[model samples]
Target: MKIALDAMGGDFAPQAAVDGAVLAAQQLAGKARIVLIGQEDAVRPLLEKHGAAAAELELVPASQIIEMGEHPAKAYQQKQDSSIAVGYRMLHTGEVEAFCSAGNTGAMLVGAMFSVKPVPGVMRPAIANFVPKLHGGLGILLDVGANAECKPEMLEQFGELGSLYAQYVLGIDKPKVGLMNLGEEEGKGTSITQAAHQLLKVNPHIHFIGNIEGRDLFNDKADVIVCDGYTGNVMLKMAESIYDIMADKKMQDPFFDKFNYEAVGGSPILGINDNAIIGHGVSTPLAICNMLLQGYQMAHSGISDQIKNTFKS
Candidate 1:
């Protein structure tokens, strides 16, 4: 497995990326191939500082970096030499099996959509997060800030994608899926939510569990939850903040330790033709290593192949 690392993409840049790559290399040993993409001069010393075998890793030079505030489309167009672009380019060409980055997520998303593009018949890609529940279960949320606005069809597709992910990745067979809504009642949401709910009920591919309110997210009533980008993103941020506050209070909660967003590594960008996982900017060496492993898992999961066969245009 050839894993590409955007060495200059995160807040800590080359140091953290190199450290994470080194950690992953140490853990996997000869099991995986890691390619670091960035300014070689700067990245090499970091690897050397850690006493890592430089020859065991490949170096791909990138001439520039993309900042968080930059527009992804504009940056990709203007800065062709950016590390994020170069990393995705390699993934698109199949030189690397997966690309991992903690850089500007918007740019990464844009480059991925325009470069490798989404699978045929995939209307739009969604970001999926693994949320840990109290009773030792994982709750998967889809379309988390990947698309601010979604159609009825998009929501239905998210349900399908989220279900497949829960089954294969989370090891949940026939996982119960619920739509995020204002209330548990059938007609509690806007026209779009109502239509999506009606459509999801008949979706043969998903085990729809009716509507789930935000308050019920922690109750472990559903394994996989579906919502538009707007609602999903807001919920994720709010949940994260609450978790942080609890942690700051020094509560001895194992659930909080296990379910932390950063602790889980990264969110997989589903529906893209290539394997791409985005980590938080503040991700540490451990997070990066885990994200690398996730990229490899998703790359070889066969979920993409199943999606292609099922949704061929």
Candidate 2:
């Protein structure tokens, strides 16, 4: 398998991208290859400086760069030669099995929607983040910043999407799906959650559990949590802040350490035609390394194909 990396997309740019590629090359040796996309002059030297042999990595030249602050649609259209745009072109044409970037999240989302498109039966594609459970395990949470305003049907679809991800990628069998709500009762949340609960309860594709409260996020009550993008995004940021605050206090608990974003590398854009992993803008070398590995895992595991089949039926 071949995974493409946007060498100029992140704050650290070519240096961190190159270093991470080298680390991933050593770890994924003989199993997969890393393709770096950026200005050749800037990327090649970094590869050499990082002691990555030419045989280990392939460089794709891109002339321009889409800055982090640029508009997603405009930058993608105007800068066709930018690293992010070129990376999407490669993914569209099947030049690589997966594409990863820590660059503009909006551009990545736009590119995935227009370039590769969504699965046939999927109403809307969802983005998912891994929730670190308290019992030394992980749960899947969906629609975390994509489609902030969702209908009840969209939330129902997210349950199926999250369930497939938990099953295929995380190796969870018969993952229990739960809707995030203020209370655990049947009619707890707003009109949307109440309607979504009815839809989820009747869906055969997912093992629908009752509503899961905020305190249950860290426990093993549910393996897949579905919520609107607005709520899910807030929950994700709040969880992230816990880690930041703990780190500031110099706390070193094993459970809290799992909250670090670097451990998961990046979150994959699920329900798309191909693998498109999005990393944090401030991703470090370790984070980028994990991002590349996650991209490779997504491709090799054939999660996209499995999702497509499920949706088609």
* Strongest candidate by lDDT: 2
TM-scores for every predicted model = 0.95, 0.98
| Candidate 2: stretches off by over 4 Å | 52-54
**How well does model 2 score by local distance difference test?**
0.91
TM-score of 1: 0.95
- For each candidate, the alpha-carbon lDDT, in order, equals 0.85, 0.91
Q: Best candidate, TM-score-wise?
A: 2
Instruction: Give candidate 1 regions above 4 Å deviation.
Output: 53-55
By summed lDDT, the worst window of 10 consecutive residues in model 1 runs over 47-56
What is the per-residue lDDT of model 2 for residues 113-231, given as tens digits with 9 covering 90 to 100?
Answer: 98889999899998899998888779999989988988999999999988988888888999999999999999999999999999999999999998999898889989999999898
RMSD of each: 1.6, 1.0
